[model samples]
Target chain A: MSQQLDLLFYSLSDQTRRDILRRLTLKELTVSQIAKPYKISLAAVSKHLKVLEKAKLIGRRRDGKNHIIHAEPKTLIKIDSWIEFYKQYWNESFDQLNTYLTTVGDTKNET
Target chain B: MSQQLDLLFYSLSDQTRRDILRRLTLKELTVSQIAKPYKISLAAVSKHLKVLEKAKLIGRRRDGKNHIIHAEPKTLIKIDSWIEFYKQYWNESFDQLNTYLTTVGDTKNET
Candidate 1:
């Protein structure tokens, strides 16, 4: 799978990770701080961070032994653009089909 | 996994289906015509169509004996909106972090 698409979906698929992202929405936090809300082990949280990292949805820097996790919103712009570009294809077709069904039912007059 | 997210990613994760979507980009196609480009089976292609249908990315209707598959673009707008909403969470945090790094880095700054 393409990394862009992989990261796009992979980042959003996990419930715990989505929760973490939601938390990060409020503020940036250290790894342990982000881990505080979950009953899962810190190691599991660490693993989640790894997934986010590979997706480029989060960035990490060490503050002594602690890692500050920051959300990268721009990382999603590509994915947005991708989905946006392809959207016209499906959208327009459905609209035409709707028109066809509404005003031209088996008229066979399309050029 | 949530069905919305499941359908979102599950639909796009496959190469054959993406190709099918791309072809649908040019025009709507029947199951057999859609299957022509791939080395895979017509049944496999039908399975792919089912996935797209489950995602609500495509729809089907019978014209006599042919199943006319039409692209449903509106289905993607929800996904686009979902991504757009979360994007703010990431974007703001990242911008704030950038600001913190730039002008307030460990300088005994008061919040």
Candidate 2:
């Protein structure tokens, strides 16, 4: 699981890869179609896709003569779960700040 | 924002960095205190801290002789928001699958 998180985060670290994943989320696309928008070579795009594939963030299905790449969003739920811990800590800090502000407001009103 | 996401995700790709962030979430610690458990040299740990600092996932404050390290959980909110888009897509697919399964069940019942 730790290794998986490593791969998942590493896969998302590149802008091109993230763009490819975002596009795939809308609809499945063939390798060539996926490679079209980028100025980079097909080989470069394929390298990014391979990283995403290794992370299980995207998967490919053979469609006759083409390979269709699609987003695997379910794998993202794990990242969500991991971040939940920190989110809770952040929320607690917000609550504390809010309480402090409210007390300061009340003190000013009393003054 | 895209470049920031790249750094944030890249910072999280390593286990040591993630572990350091997790530890800081509990309480702020001096650089030496943070380096205590790891078998790696202080310089190696400092390298991980530098990555986390560059990402703004952790922050440092000077306290007399010590540099205190603390987790910046607020930075993680951005990642949560990014994952929100994919979660919606995942849920939509789940709903579609549910409708299909229900229709298949109805057909079986009629037979």
Candidate 3:
């Protein structure tokens, strides 16, 4: 799971890959179409696609000779859950601290 | 911002660092206390702390000779916002597709 997340984050860490993902989120596009806006070579774009594919963030379908790439939004849900876990953990800790402080205040009032 | 996220995700890519973040989330702990549970060397744990610090996921304060490490949950919020942007984008696209499909169904029924 950690390795999967590592690949997912590493794939997203690049500007070009993120751009590709943003574009893919709108609609499925051919490899050439996705690569058209960038100044990088087709090979570079292919490399980015490979990374995205490895992370399962995007899926590729071959239609005749053209490769169609679409964003896999579900993978993002996995990341969301991971972040949510930490968010809840932090919230719980803060609640505990708040309770402790309140108890301390009540004790001082009694004194 | 991409670079900062790259650092943030990169710092989290490792299991040890994630564990450290989890521990810090519970309460502030000294470098020694954080390192005590693991079999690795103190230097190795320190290196992990450095990565977490660079990502701003954890902060250290010098109290006498001890460096107190605490979790900075706000950095996770930045990541949450980034993910939320994509989530909204994908949701909007899905809504558009749903509308189009509904229109197509109505046209088919009218025929």
Pick the lDDT winner.
2
Docking class of 3: acceptable
Task: Give lDDT tens digits, candidate 1, residues B1-111.
Answer: 366766766587666776787677667888888998789999989998998898888888999879988777677776677677777664665688888887766556566
Q: What is the TM-score ranking, best to worst?
A: 2, 3, 1
Error (Å) of candidate 3 at residue B4 is 1.4
Best-matching candidate per TM-score = 2
- lDDT score of residue B109 within candidate 2: 55
Instruction: Give the higher-TM-score candidate: 1 or 3.
Output: 3
lDDT of each: 0.77, 0.92, 0.86
Name the regions of candidate 1 deviating beyond 4 angstroms.
Answer: A87-111, B87-111
Give the candidate order by descending DockQ. Answer: 2, 3, 1
lDDT of 1 at A5: 73
Better of 1 and 3 by lDDT: 3
- Candidate 1 chain B, which ten residues in sequence have the lowest lDDT sum? B1-10
Per-model tally of clashing residue pairs: 1, 0, 0
Q: Which pairs clash in model 3? A: none
Candidates 2 and 3 compared by lDDT, better number: 2
- The DockQ of each candidate is 0.32, 0.79, 0.40
Give the per-residue lDDT of model 1 (tens digit) for A40-109: 9999999999988888878888889889998776777866877776776646656798887877665567
